[model samples]
Target: MQCGFAAGSPCEVTCTRVTLPDLCGHLFLDWNFSFAGLIVEEGASEWQLRYAFYGDGDAGWVHVLVAAPLAEKTFPSIVKFVHAADWHEREAEDLFGIHFEGHPRLGDFILHDDAWQEGVEPMRRKFDPREAMRHRKPDEDWRPHRIVQEPGAFVMPVGPKYSGVTESVHFLLETVGEDVIRSTPRLFYKWRAIEKLAEGKSADEVLLLAERFAATTAFAHGLAFCQAAETVCGANVPPRAMTLRVFLAELERLRQHAGAIQEICESTALAVANAHAGICEEELLRISGEITGHRYLFGLLTLGGLLCDLANDACAKALEKSQKVLSQLNALEKHLRVSSSFLDRLEEVGIVPERTAMVYGLLGPIARASGMVRDLRRAQPYLGYENIQFDVPFEEEGDGYARLRILFAEARQSVRIMEQAVGALQSGNVRERIELRAGAALGWVEAPRGGAFHWVRLDGNGKVARYRIIPPSFANWHGFHLSVEKFAFQDFPIMLSTFDLSVAENDR
Candidate 1:
């Protein structure tokens, strides 16, 4: 049934597989909605594919559901109309063996062909993890696909393995000369299947998995999961708890942006700038540890609210230290702007056009850097963000410098938000007792890199039945190649550092 929807309420409509693409196009292109994420779930006899969307300004969410029969598990691909569904379609196909009829590419997505067998379908009901592990075989005939096919063109494989603490992600940079003509990223080298693991587990058990999946953005993901669970159980959070949630969220954002700036500085060989940014990042981590008792703010978020109430003095102290760090970040930004060498490498290199960002559904800072002013905190205010006063920083240039400026701007704004949240703190219960019930809901947050969406469904026993995470890195990774393409090979790392996407987030 189709119904009028409010900003937070979802209006879901059931449609046949035949009219799936047209309906998706109608809602997305004609109605002007942003493709949020595609969620696929297996039922008793059929597969349900839900196409989720969110709109700007006063608009609400619209979900299109298509049921593909088990006899012939197939559905018309919506990638031709909505380009953002590319990776999502591939992931569903890989895990469930549900073929998207017109999908251009489908195999070797989460389950890499070189490592996993062809028809394992780990997400299927009949499949067993131990059984699959006992009989493992790598596809020896596997070869990386190439797009650039000129006389002197050759593909340079970067890595599924790299030096330092970087996660495994192979990059196929196809080039004819000095310029990279095509760039293909092969991620999910370490797919932990967190979603698959969440099946049948209680909400509390799954919360632990959610936070650990992406350590860098732990609080954001954990909070999102908690929000979904709270919504499912119809739990109400106290105003003070809501205020603290925003405060902690901004703290994570502040630290993440500082780390991003540090990486960008290191990428451009700015030794002093790198050290200064790193120092700021370390200080923020220390502050996080002092406040939440965890360096990454884990073990703090629960079903309806926070695990513990933060003392007023602790909040004040953290805010003061964060303000000093912001000032240092501002000084660093000013110095980098005057540095000609840094500007030359970042100014126009790796540009993602505004239209491309919109079509690809780029989220968070990456989308904002391209002049797309879509932030969930402001657009769909949640967790007391509606009461907070701050600006959603954006840039029209969409270059490396634009991305860098966004990081700094957002970091400053995060401090401003933290101040407001801390000043408004009240003495009360930080958490509400929530009795779990069977339901499904979507929870979202504007993380440091971009918007992170978590869709969760609970069984009758209050255990997780279906869990889907669409992290900012996963959404932004699609458009990452657009920036790398046509840019010189020398600017690759600099361009990548600007995005600051998490490989661990994608692998999950």
Candidate 2:
């Protein structure tokens, strides 16, 4: 698939060596027009690297998966693949210690909170993570990101720690007179070495580990982890389990979306709107607890099936609750649209251009808000989503208002999806463990934020030899940073509230 720059615009046909990474980007310049982003998975050894590229297409998502074994531990960096590969490549360097020979910025990223000592790569299987932490040493070469200082420019440090909704992230903003020149992100303060933790554990045990990585969408994470395990082992999930998984997952999405809207209102000082949306969020969580036995919907899924059959008429109850909450959400949205002050605060703030969002394949509501019609649930259906119908909403404006509108629209669709899934349920067995084979595969889902991807490598005994979890937060964090560039410093809180990111999820 080698293609070189014939003209400066697009490639003529297949060319030769892609060894020069710059050519990789220049070669796909046409693809970048529609290119979303890609997720990289290093195989059992350095023998192969599997990539799932959701690149250029009519919907801005040519969702396809392919694998290519590399000839060496080092492969040419694809910083040229898309404008956003810069961050993904750095992540590879931090986690697997892969050398991205020409990456502009390659150093400690997510694990920057003194989580590990210098020269320690926690995500690698051979390294003992505990030992890496015990041997922690300050990086001598680590220095504050250098940027050309404008007149009156000064470095402003926000936090690597917070006790509120935000996770542990240290933001170093270069600003002059309240105008941000650049925002440097220091993440992974809560990095628990998740991929390393999953190693050597059973698939069942891995579910528990994976769910904790992203607290808000625990069900989606659990489902993705189990799906990878099931796919590698050729296990079959029952019909009832499929429908139930969809139901619980939508419930998780509803709560997150509702909460996102509430925060957006709060960020604008719209206390009345926040109160109304906050009540809806609490109600959604209450009903989730009533059905799943956990507000986060944990402990309900297992490999091949579920922990147990869902409560009798659980579907009917969920539909009833969803309908009520949707009504409340509709009211809240109506109020928000007419609130001139609130709309003014959100409009044109934190604008993320369509090209930027598409380049990152920014997942979930964020990408949808940017007019990118790429929802994994629609593009690649899993867990009975094929039988359900709902609109994949998009907006031309990629601002805080657009994001807030997406939260409401997605919540409405989630209710519709759950209603259909509930009515389509049929009688079936729910639990049975399957004998797994030694292999590897990727599993993912339309998480609250975006797609939560889990790549699993099982050993001969069906034990996890390696695990990689890339949640939506990790993928979209860059998009958030990009949106805030040159924006006023005061807009930081508003932008952050609309992004509604889970730092715990990203830092992992």
Q: Specify the highest-TM-score model's number.
A: 1
CA lDDT, candidate 1, residue 457: 96
Q: How would you encode candidate 2's per-residue C-alpha lDDT over 136-228 as one tens digit per residue?
A: 566565558659466677888887664365567888888876677788777777867777778888877888988877778888888999998
Candidate 1 achieves a global lDDT of: 0.89
Tell me each candidate's TM-score: 0.97, 0.89
| lDDT winner | 1
Candidate 2 runs further than 4 Å off: 1-47, 55-73, 113-116, 130-143, 162-165
True-vs-predicted CA distance for residue 28, candidate 2, Å? 6.5
C-alpha lDDT of residue 293 in model 2: 80
For model 2, which pairs clash?
Answer: 25-80, 159-170
Cα deviation of 376 in candidate 1 (Å)?
Answer: 0.7
Candidate 2: deviation at residue 500, Å? 2.1
lDDT of 2: 0.75
The lDDT for every candidate, in the order shown, is 0.89, 0.75
